[model samples]
Structures are given as C-alpha cells and as structure tokens.
Target: MKKDNKLKLNLQAILTDLLIWIYILGCVSFLVNHWFEKIIQTNFVVIFGVAAGFISFILGLSIGRKIFLPTIKTEGKWYKTFWGWSVFLLLLITFIVGWNLVEVDLYKLFAKFQNAGGIMKGIFNPNMDIFMQCLAALAETIYLALLATAFAIPLAFFLSFFAARNLMPQTFLGNTVYIIVRTIATIFRSIEAIVWAIIFSVWVGIGPFAGMLALMIHSIASLTKLYSEQIENINPGPVEAIKATGANTIQTWIFAVVPQIISPFLAFTIYRWDINVRMATIVGFVGGGGIGLLLLQQQQMLRWQNVGIIIWMIAIVVWIMDMVSAKVRGKLQEM
Candidate 1:
C-alpha cells in the first residue's frame, strides 16, 4: 500500500488560475519582445526598487522554510507554519509588484492641493449665500447615498442567501452560485464610483441620476460582501430548527438569519451610507454631480467663500451622519 502524507500536492483551483497564468505569460513575452527598449526599465526596477528589496527579504525566508518544509519523514507543526508563510510571502510579492507597476505620483497629487492655497483659505471663510447653496447640494448627495443603501440592502440580502453555504441550493450548485455572486460584487466594487458615474453619465446624461446609479452599484457590491460574511457566521441552530419544521429555504433564512443579524445589518447599512456620502464628494469631483462639483468649480474660479461654504456643508453633513449612526448602532446593540 502507498503511504499518503497529509500534505499532498495542492490541487485546489483558484478563481482565475488560467487567466492569471495567461496574463503573467503575456507580460513576460511582451517584455522579451521589447527587450532592447525594456531592459533598462526592468533592470532599474528589479535592481534598485523597494519592491525588489522586499522580494529578496522574502526569498531569503526559503532557507528557514526549507528546514521547516515537511519531508515525508517530517510532518511537524513548524513545517506547516512555514508552508503557510511561503504562500503569504508569494501573495505579498505579487501585490508589491502590481502596485509598483501602477506608477502613482504622490508628489504631483500633493502639488494639486498646494496650487489651491487661496481656495483653501476661502473654504474656511463663512458666507451665507454659498453656505445655503452647498446645503442643498449636500442634501442631494445624502439622498443619493440613502437611496443607494435602500436598494443595496434588499439586493444584498437575497444574494447573501444564495451565497451562504447552509442556505445554498446544494453544495456544488450553491458554491457555483456563491462564486458568481461574489465575482459580480468584486467587479463592481473594483470599479470606482467616479468611473461608474462617468459611464452612466455617458449613457443617461449627466445629473444626480448618474451619481445615484453609480452609488447604487458600488453600494450593492460592497454590502453583498459584508452581508455574505455575516450570513455565513450566523448561528445554525435556528436555521436547522426551521428546516426541521419543514420550513422552505427562504422561510428558514427569514426566520433564522434575519432575526439574528438584522440589527447589525442595519447598523452596517447606515454606516456605509455615511461613508458613501464621503465618497460622493470625490465622485462629484469627477462630475458625479454633488457639492463636490460646486467645490471644484469654486476652487477653479477662486471663489474662496464658496469653497468655505462647501467645506462647512460637508463638515455638518458628516457630523450629523456620525451622530446618527452612533445613536442607531448603540440602540441596535442593546436590542
């Protein structure tokens, strides 16, 4: 009989195994094809980059891991621990390389703000007319965020049921559905609200409608992730009891998971809406259409008082949201 060790070859499939390989292969081939032009760039990054230093530090861990790597004779705890570290190191290296390749300009980002010194001053100065105007726009932003949460809450609820391992149709079909929903959430979340707004603006014409849709999509994606995790963590007792009582899947979920998690879910939704309002400012910076749009315009026109009003408007809105969420969350926890 063959002796089977606990650590057999890892056969688990990643979400994008083939796609990852293809992209990695493509990048390598592309670099090789343009080697004459790319050699300097690649060498500079690999030889002197912080990412390279981090990579080397991690590569050095192999020496320690080798001693820990379980041989057929050594199925020790240290070996398993080292093995997990190796996987983490691999992921860290990948993230560093990808981040470096993005070529972010931290200096230029700061410089943009520095150029608006006068606008910054005006943002501090109080003005009644502009202040009232900003209030109206901010109200719109809040409304957009609230509406998005409303849509996302119900949508995410349904998706989470499909995503929950206990609540899924069956193991294989349930897992497949879970993955699909997870993928959709990931893709939507990956696309910034500004980008979504831009796409919608093109499709539906620019206004609060475009902004509302963008917030809605992003909110759904984000809330789904949280909702799924919460659903998965819920107690199985009520669910099992409900099932035993001949309750259908939907009924079981409603009676069991909903009762246990609704408070936390509502708290999270309120908190997310507050965050979305903050994000709405940035989204409007790129024509998502909120008080941020007015802020941008005022800064450009050097209307410092108007900028001041916008800042105050944002500050007030955010402060109110903070207090509201805190109060609601406290009450929910008590319940």
Candidate 2:
C-alpha cells in the first residue's frame, strides 16, 4: 500500500517537472523574440501547444494509472527511478540547448505547412497506369535482390571462415586473409546501396542491372557479417576432431562448421533477400532503375492515382515477401 503511494507520488513529481520544463521552453522562445533583435514569434504555437500539453498530461496520467491495476503487486523501483531521472536530465538538457540555440516564428511555419498541404493531399490520389508500370518494375527489383543474394551467399560462406579468428591458422598468412575479408566487408557496408546504385547506373546505364549491382555489394557485406558470426559461434569440438584425423583446413571446415551453420546461413540469406528487395525499390529512385523509377516519374508527372497504386502495390509485395521469408527462415532453422 505504501509503495503504491510512493509510485503515485513519483508519477506526480515527474508530471510536475514536465510541466515546469514546458513553461521554461515557452519562455526560452519568448526570449528570442524580445531579445537580441531576433523576433521569434513563438506565441501563437506556444499558447496552443502548452494547452494541448496539459491536456495530454492529464490523459497520460490516467493511462499510467490504468496500466497498473489495483491487484498488481509492485516490485523494486530502482530501475524505474534510474531510467526516469536519466530521461528527465537528458530531455531537460536538450530543451535548454534547443531554446537558446535556435528561434523561429510560428506564423512562417504555419504558412509553409499550409502551402505544402495541397501537394501532400494530392499524393493520395495516384495514377493507375503508372502504378501498374511500377508493379512490373517492382518484380524486376525482386529478381535483382534474389540474384544478388544467391551470388553473395556461397561467396560469403568462403570469406567468413577465413575471417573468423578461431577457425583460421595463427600465422601472418591467415591473419592477412582475415584482414582482407574484414576490410572488404567494412568498405562495402560503409557505402550506402543508393550511392552504389548511382555509380552503377552511370556505368551500366539506367536499368535493373545497376540496382542488382548495388544489392550484390550490400549483400556481400551483410552476408559476410552474418556468416562470420555463425562460423565463430559453431561447436569447435567437431572442427578439432576433424583436424586431428589429418584433414586439411578446407576438409575440416566442410566436415564441421558447414554442416552446423548451413541452416542458419540459409535463414539469414532469405531474410536479407527480402530486405534487399524492399531497399532495391527505393534505390531505383536514384536512377538505378526499378519500381522507384516508375514511382518517381509518376510523381513528377502529377499522376496521383498512379502514385497511389504504386505505393499500394509496393506495400503488398513487401508484405508478401515478409511473410514468405519468415516461413522459409523458420523451416530452415528447424532443419
């Protein structure tokens, strides 16, 4: 009973602090307008925002109470206290810096919002023919992702064993191989696929080929990480036993690690392919050529209904891919 009271008190204290912070934020903006000749009109928004803040505060308080029913037993509150204080301090510092750091008039923001409103609304009614065109492009995007992932999976498997410190020989020769593999993975992952796609599009000309190249590079990096982790985590006893029987490094790896992690590798590859398909669609916008090219063209042409169809079709494809990938991964894991 006493603990419950303490929780309620803590909640109240937290809410009170938030209210004080809100007022301080308003005042900070208020200062920018009246001081330093920088007229920041925060009044119109400040007034309404502050009012909404209070209303939200009351609603949030009620929700918090509702989450913990009367029958629920409370536990140690140290973690909660630590998290609450940490968050409060972080947010308080953020607000303090934000107020003095920048100032803007509410009216200008409102005007910009009003101006963009119509175009944003028009985005909903997309063009149907352009959308159908996007669907075809999206299929090409999926195909590129599939092909890239297929190429990367086996290649990554070979790279990861060399990369794994435990599996490789403890000589300069082995360490060099590890360094090379790691360096390649890091370089590939560091560059965004869209950037890769941009470069490839220039090299190959605008088409799915550029997108496939981008996906392949990205997949090599991502698959290397997943494969290396799986290789490093595999049971070492079988590897050691195989090595003792006069087996070569390749033979030992084939006998031990490959059998253990093949399922997981397949699972990871399937999941990555699904993710790549979705990313491939977006990369097309940068001239790599996929559904995104169609979507962008439609948007530029003011084909709202087509744009709507493109978005919906993309969503459906992504959803199906997710489901299919999950099921396939689950089966691979079971195997």
lDDT of each: 0.71, 0.76
Worst 10 residues of 1 by lDDT: 6-15
Model 2, residue 12: C-alpha shift (Å)? 41
* Candidate 2 pairs with clashing backbones: 125-304, 125-305, 126-304, 126-305, 126-306, 126-308, 127-304, 127-305, 127-306, 127-307
The runs of at least 3 residues in candidate 1 whose Cα sits more than 4 Å from the true structure, single-residue gaps closed, are: 1-117
Query: Across residues 1-335, which tens digit of lDDT does each residue of candidate 2 receive?
Result: 99988778657644554554465555555555546666655665466545644554454432223243324343455335433443465467566656656764667777778766545665576555555466678878889888888888878877888778788788899889988988889889899999999999999988888888888988889889889988889889998899899999789888988998989988998899998989888888988677888878877987566677778888989999999999999888788
lDDT of 1 by residue, 1-335 (tens): 12232222111121122233333344443445454444334443333433433343354433222333324243456446533455465466566555556756788788788677776667666667765677778888888777877888889877777766666766777779978988888999999888998898788876677788888899888888888788888888888898999988778877988998898888888888988888888777777777877888887887787778788878888998899988998998899
Colliding residue pairs in candidate 1: 122-304, 123-308
Question: Could you say which candidate leads in lDDT?
Answer: 2
Q: In order, how many clashes per candidate? A: 2, 10
Please give the RMSD of candidate 2 to the true structure. Answer: 11.6
Per-model TM-score versus the true fold: 0.71, 0.68
RMSD of each: 7.4, 11.6
Instruction: Show where candidate 2 strays beyond 4 Å.
Output: 1-126
